[model samples]
Target chain A: MDQNYSTIGRSSRTKQAIEINKVLRNTYLLLAMTLLFSGLTASISMMMNMPPMTYLISVIGGMVIAMFVLPRFAHSTAGIGIVFLITGLLGFGLGPILSMYASVPNGSNIIMLSLGGTGVIFMGLSAYVLATRKDFSFLGGFLMVGFLLVLVAAVANIFLAIPAMSLMISAVVIMLMSGFILHDTSRIIHGGETNYILATIGLYMTIFNIFISLLQILGIMGGDD
Target chain B: MDWMKIVAALALIMFIVYLFPRARHMMENSPKGSSADWMGFVVPILVIVLFVMLLVQLV
Candidate 1:
């Protein structure tokens, strides 16, 4: 009976590992596709010299899709389309920012630097979580609270119009998003997150925020426009 | 009246206060992260720093 129990436990563990791996694989594949779609739309928006109003529209559209459409389709095959639409819209929003940055002195360099920094951070944090197999679920509450604080601060800073405060907000966002990457990736590894679409969205948002935050900081520090 | 700013400030302060207890709880329940985990965390920091350095050079 003891031997049978041990065998059962081992088998369950193996099955759990397999399930986690499958989810991770699917999440990554979908994430890559969504990111590409987003980039393509962003490039198009850039080429078209889209206005700031486009940014506002894209933000609202992406938020609506994420809040309503994505959740409704998260478990279905349609989730893929919804994910693409959300990411593509967000990417479209990036056009004005990218254009603004591109017009700055040495703007292209800053953009490239921000993009590289974002990629490095995402890959490094993700690899760390995967390699360590460390459960970062404990960070869930901390991240939620952190996010709330940051959001409030961000809104407040807009009226305050304090440069220093804006810089600090950007820095805090970088840390928060980095932590999220770890937490979200660990969730996939530990079977806490099973839906590939949801997982992709989580990771994508984290990456998006990180990139934007980095760009803001870099632009403020080095931009001449 | 600037009620919006006042309400936002109050909410922000309350949230900040709430973080203390939540942080304490988080610390107590934190997982045992290994060296590899630490390395992973540091990678992003280093990348950010490196890019900042690059940007500073341009300036």
Candidate 2:
């Protein structure tokens, strides 16, 4: 009886391990594809010399999908399609920012640096969580509070228009996004997150924020040249 | 140099400090891992910090 019980327990653990691995694999594969699609859209938008209004519209559209469509379709095949739409819209919005930077002195350098930095940070944080297998679920509440505070500060800064404050906000966001990468990856590994679509979204958002924050800082620092 | 930046930086620091203990406690109780694994994560952070510092210095 003891032997049978031990075998059953071992198999249960094995099944869980398989399930977790499957989710991680699917999430990563889908994330890579979405990123490529986003890049393609961003490039197309840049070539067309899209206006600011396009960015505004894309931002609103992406938010609508994120807030409404995503949650509803997250478990279906449509979830993957919606995810691509959100990424494409976001990428389209990014085109104007990239164009603005490219028009300035040393702008291309700043863009490259930001892109490289984002890639390194994302890979590093994700690998760390996977290597350590440490549960960072505890960070969820802290991150949420930090996010809300940052959002409020950002909106207020638009009216206040303090450059130094803006710099600080970007710095804070870079750190926050890095922490999110760690937290989200850990969640997937520890089984706290079971849905690949949701997992992909969390990781994608982290990358997006990190890239934007780094670009802001680097642009300011390099623009004078 | 404005008061806003100063205040914002201070607030951010305080929040991180307050949250540090909880994170440390969790890490402490986590499964044993090789030191190399920890370095895998820390190295990236150090690189990112250096990049940020370089940008700030240029400002």
Candidate 3:
């Protein structure tokens, strides 16, 4: 009787693990699709010749709305609303990329190069986390500090229009977003986040920021306007 | 190739990912399940199709 009960317990645990794995897999797949959609939207917007000033204003508005609304309402729609809002925000954020690409020669090539670089960094950092299985939760606070500093620098640079400051911000963003990928993935593996939608969104934001920053760096380095 | 098609496809992908887990769990727990039990198949296919279409458009 005890043996039968033990077998049942083990099977139940196995079933739970499988369910968690399914959630993780689904989240990664969805994240990939979101990135693709964001890319396509950006490309299309550029092709359509949207004004950069309007795009910048929309991005700012989107960020404000997302920050205020998402956390308050995320659980209401079983997280579906947050997912939709993220997708829309990402699409809108891609506007600057589209505008920059249109303004520069060899824009598509730069975009692709940036995409490839982002993929490489993501894969490398993710593999390091997975192989080591080290908890990076400690980095969370540090990452937040870095993010705030970058935000301040970015706002200041807007008025200064200093090229060196832009490069510094882009470099810092690349590093910060990489740290985020490590921290976010560790959360998923450790079961810190059970909801795959939330997990995917976190990971997707990290990837998006990394790609955008890398593209900016490339533009500054090699772009011919 | 057009923006509308891309947007529509993305929306469909979002819907599928949103629905798949519940659908899968429901099917697994249902007694009268048919060959349609493999509903999860649609999610990955939609993802792949959209991915391919995006790449093609990019090129």
Error of 1 at A36 (Å): 0.9
- Give the per-residue lDDT digits (tens) of candidate 3, residues A54-96: 4554454445445556667656554565666566666765876
- lDDT-wise, the better of 1 and 2 is 1
State the weakest 10-residue window (summed lDDT) of model 1 chain A. Answer: A136-145
Regions more than 4 Å wrong, model 3: A1-16, A76-78, A223-225, B1-59
Clashes of 2: 0
DockQ comparisons of all candidates to the true complex: 0.18, 0.10, 0.02
Where does candidate 1 stray beyond 4 Å? Answer: B1-59
- The TM-scores of chain A alone, one per candidate, are 0.96, 0.97, 0.85
- In candidate 3 chain A, where is summed lDDT lowest over 10 consecutive residues? A53-62
How far in Å is the alpha carbon of A152 misplaced in model 1? 0.9
Angstrom error of the Cα, residue A117, model 3: value is: 0.9
Q: Which candidate is the best by DockQ?
A: 1
Interface RMSD (Å), every candidate: 5.5, 8.4, 17.0
Clash list (residue pairs), candidate 1: none
Q: Name the top lDDT candidate.
A: 1
Question: What order do candidates take by TM-score, descending?
Answer: 1, 2, 3
**Comparing candidate 1 with candidate 3, which one achieves the higher DockQ?**
1
User: How close is chain A of candidate 2 to the true chain A, as a TM-score?
Assistant: 0.97
